[model samples]
Target: MPKIIVEVMPKADLLDPQGKAVAGALGRLGHSAITDVRIGKRFELTVEGEVTEQILADVATLADEIFSNQVIEDVTSIRVEEAQA
Candidate 1:
């Protein structure tokens, strides 16, 4: 079996309100050294039986189509890790 890891983040060109708020709060709390903070989502899926390039491609397509909002978010990265023996 293999695993698919998907990471989603706000588009680099757009402003992240949540991240800004967190950073502001941190600054107010005397953590001014923390210049920025960004939040993102991570998902891990276990794939069994079939391990093909098409399967992996489908997973990526599905992730982009459903899990992430192409308008406001972007797919940061996708990692396919083989199971440990």
Candidate 2:
């Protein structure tokens, strides 16, 4: 099986409230070195067949359509890597 890794994150043009809140909390905790915090999600899925362009495309489409909200986030990247020897 092929493994798919999907990284989802908020568009750069959009404001991330969760990230902002985490940053604010960090500041309150005296973490001066930390300036910003961005929230994102990682999803790993196993495609039940050989890794191919069509499989990759379908996985990306499914992730965007169901796993994430396109309104608040964008699919940053999709990587298909071999599972382990």
Least well predicted 10-residue stretch by lDDT in candidate 2: 47-56
Q: Candidate 2, which segments miss by more than 4 Å at Cα?
A: none
Which pairs clash (backbone N, Cα, C closer than 3 Å) in model 1? none
lDDT for residue 82 in candidate 2, whole number 0-100: 92
- Over the stretch 4-63, how does candidate 2's per-residue lDDT look in tens digits? 999999888899999999999999999989998889999998878788888878887888
Q: Which 10-residue window in model 1 sums to the lowest lDDT?
A: 48-57
TM-score of 2: 0.86
All candidates: TM-score? 0.86, 0.86
The TM-score that candidate 1 achieves is: 0.86
- Tens digit of lDDT per residue, candidate 1, span 1-84? 788889999988889999999999999999989999889889888898756889879878987999799999999898888888
